[model samples]
Target: MSPELYITAGAALAAVVVVILLFKAVWRVAEPNEALIISGLGARRRGGDVDSLGFKIITGKGAAVMPGFQAARRLRLDTRAANLQVSCVTQQGIPVHIRGVVIYKVGDDFASIANAARRFLDQQDFMTSAIHELFTGHLRSIIGNLTIEDLILNRERLTSETRASAADEMSKLGLVVDSLQIQEIDDETGYIVNLGKPHAARVAATARIAQAQRDQEATEAEQVAAANMAAARRDARIKEAAYQAEIDRAQATSRQAGPLSEATARQEVVVQETRAAELEAQLAEQRLQSQVRKPADAKAYETRTLSQAERDARIAQAEGEAQATRTRGLADADAARALGLAQAEASQAKGLAQAQAISARAQALKDNQEAVIAQQLAERWPEIVEAGAKAFGGVDHMVVLNGAQGVEEMLAKALTLGGAGLGLARVLLNGNTPNDSNSENGLKATESRE
Candidate 1:
């Protein structure tokens, strides 16, 4: 090689080594889990806005940081867990020991990174101690607000409340909590143990209840399956029996088909014969009624009619005789009554004037005989009419073949009896006892009525 070429090569190599050294001095790269906070002379943003981050934040990229002018700090963004043990008072005022862990990381945002770089960039190794101290205070504060039961039972609630309470402070510290876990809570007064005892008992009881419900469901399922199986078997047997009975019935019916058919035919024939017999009997009955019974009935009706007519005639005769007899007896009774009245009047007049009383009465009766009779007839009019009506009182029904004429004749006969009574009264008023004449007259009236 030539000397000049060697000198040129040395200069180029020296230039490359210088560039590499400068790059080594100025270049800064942030890992995926880290943020690079470059601060110093040129770290300010464009236009030099006072509100802009004084330090440049780079994440997952390379940045040129001038040595001794711009200082680059790597803020680890990877999660860090800080174990914390603190003694705090719960909401119930029971003093408890709480051991907890806080998983935290540096914020990704420029402001958060700037804040974290400002606070913890110098000593990243002390982050755990800082987080531990920070979480101890936070745990104490949060646990003071929370009951032992809340702490024991509701971890989510406790974590949320803790995050909320520490959010602003952690923002200032440029840290974000990924998880806040309460590892253990110890109660020196046995409050936690006692509290867990009841919960444990309830959990055990609930488990037992669930188990019993499952057992009961299983038992019920078994019983239902058994009953269903039994029912299925019974139904199968019943169906078999029914099928057997149907088969037997079908065979029996097949065997008896001929006989039954014959019997049916015979039954139809018998029915027809019976109907014919009934028709024949009806014909005979009609023939008998027309030929013999009808004529006999007609003859019997004629005989009965003749006998009834004769009986009616006899009854009429007897009734007329009885009416005449009654009318005559009534006339005689009226005459007797008139005699008694006359005697009584005579006796009364005798008391007033004994002499000539009979003569005076006889004279008065002779002079006003018609007036006396009129008065007596008027007074006895109702009685006379009633006596006349008695003639037909015993007759339930009188079928008058002569129609209205016969009715008129019976009325005339009754009126004749009434006239006879009047005649007898007139005879009595005339001071003549017309016994034989009235009797003969009554007999003549009865004969005429008959």
Candidate 2:
């Protein structure tokens, strides 16, 4: 490159740099936190209808400003805080000192910027002092309208009252209050402090009561757990004792196992020996039954048979003798009966003859009963003798107690019986005794003769 061309290029580059710098100086930008106020030049005339200040406002953008004909001023739209302290009285006439902070910013609208630019553009750093003075008067007025209780507890009401009291005046300044906070209050009479004493005491008492109740419940739970632990320990000890007893019993039983086994073996041997002895005894009994018992039973049976046969034969002989005695007695009885019947007939015939003779004699000599009875006796003499002989008809032999004279006296007695029948015949013939009596007298006389 040529030297002249190099100088021309350098000159052109310097001119471009100067133009860029001039453009930068003339083109002012408004940040989001600030507004640019342009006055002088025809730029003010562009927004004079809206703001009536002949100033143009730009915010959050850039505008071309002529260097000398127009001027740009930055009005900060960022938030600012002002501290306020005021001595005031509440609606209840309680004197208090209030300390607060008010947060505010310049309005971002063009008219607000124009209004702010006309008033505070040259003294931006003095904004807090002006806001602090303005809000102090407003806060005093706000506190005067509200009670101490409302100021203490009602933040919304405090804010609303602040806005109501300061809104129009701050609008004239093109400022908006973002917040007005009452940071602290000093009660000269201790009224506000006294107001919270009862609630604080009640909250303290309630907290203490809750803590005591929790402590009591925890103590009771701990005591119950201790009791349960003791009971569990006692039960565990009892169970352990029972298990130990069982273990001891098992060990004792194990220790006695040898003796028990030996006793059982001995018992088994004894039982076997007893069974063998019993078998031998049974075999001996069977042998005795087959040998000695059979022969003894046969001998006893033969002797018993012979004794029974002999006894039976003797019984038969005695029975035969008794039968013969009975037959002989029967034969003698029959013969005696026949002879007695003959004697009775003979006596009856003799009595009848005597009765007929006495009856004939009584008829012949009606007053001579003795004579007639005597004649009946004489006529029945032979029948009397025959009836006396018939009395000995069944006797095979006779023994006279005396000599032949006894025979003569027996004949006389027999003849006297015939005379007794004479008395019966006399009674029959006379018709003084009954016939039955006469027959009875006749039977008596015949029995006497026998």
Candidate 3:
């Protein structure tokens, strides 16, 4: 082991290390985020046909090739985001500024990876900008079929239209869109605001109506609660008053019990005393009736008997006087009848005598010269005086207040009355004529002769 031998060994070891490092350095790796594109000489491909692409694309693995003979390129397979700002007219001819984001990824298939490798392998940093310009024209066509409200509210329709417009164009670029978002919408003519105006106002009015209804219900509930509270208070007061009245009645009954019992006992005692006094008084009255009233009645009956006997004696005396008066009256009547019979006999004789004289005069007047006789009444003066005296003789008293001369004068006048009658007869006889002097008397005379 000399120093020259150690130096040669060290050179060989360094050369082997350099060759391994060079081999490792020339080998290209395809990461999970990218695809590796290899070209220029002896690149192993899967297909035998030469008309197929000559280059090879590999993803998610590593490969070894000579560094000078092979060239390798990388294309990103991971998701990429692009900010899209497009100013274009829609198919409906409305101009709009659409700001959006597109999320895309390179295709994993061999053909799609090969196409992406050729186009964007050297400019991977500028992938987003390229996808933005490509999507601008496609977005215009998509928006043409949509309205402002459909873009804002109907996201599903917006996405469907975007896919229909941009799907084919994006396929050519070897990228698939995971999502497209219209981040901001600018409506130059207030189309979006006016579109939402009716619904916004309706929502605002409905909110106010619901709030007012709730407030009114709350107020009514408050009033009902207050009324219930007042009713409860009134019931409580009524119950308290009823209980107080019951307590007062009970106290009054308790206070009166002793006095009421005493009064009842006193009344019963007074009734018993009154009954005893009535019995005693009845016994006394019965004794007095038998002793005093019976004897007094006997004495009164004896006095009445004596007075009745004395009255009977007086009645007999008065009856005897009445019998004597009746006997005297019968005797006076018998005497008076006898006198009336004598007067009747005298008057009959006088009337017979006067009738005889009148018949004789009438015969004389017819048979003789029918002359009337003149008479002297001096002889008949005594008769005329007797007749005049008899007229006043039946009077019991001659009451002459002119004294003794009046009585004598009355007797003389009675006697002289017959003389006065004689004077009138004398004058009557002076005018008398015989009945035969008349001419009609001749007819009476001739009838008398027959």
Error of 1 at 285 (Å): 19
The models' CA-based lDDT, in order, is 0.76, 0.77, 0.69
Total clashes, candidate 3?
0
Stretches of candidate 1 exceeding 4 Å from the true structure: 1-33, 39-56, 59-61, 66-71, 87-95, 109-111, 141-146, 150-172, 199-225, 252-450
The candidate that achieves the highest lDDT relative to the unseen native structure: 2
Off by over 4 Å in 2: 45-51, 236-259, 271-450
Query: Predictions ranked by TM-score, top down?
Result: 2, 3, 1
CA lDDT for candidate 1: 0.76
- Residue 302 local lDDT, model 1: 67
Q: What would the per-residue lDDT of candidate 1 be over residues 190-293, giving only the tens digit for each residue?
A: 99888778879999999999999999999999999999999999999999999999999999999999999999999999999879766755765566456544
Candidates arranged by lDDT, highest first: 2, 1, 3
User: By the TM-score metric, which is better: model 1 or model 2?
Assistant: 2
lDDT of 3 by residue, 56-90 (tens): 77788998766789888778788889998877654
Which scores better on lDDT, 2 or 3? Answer: 2
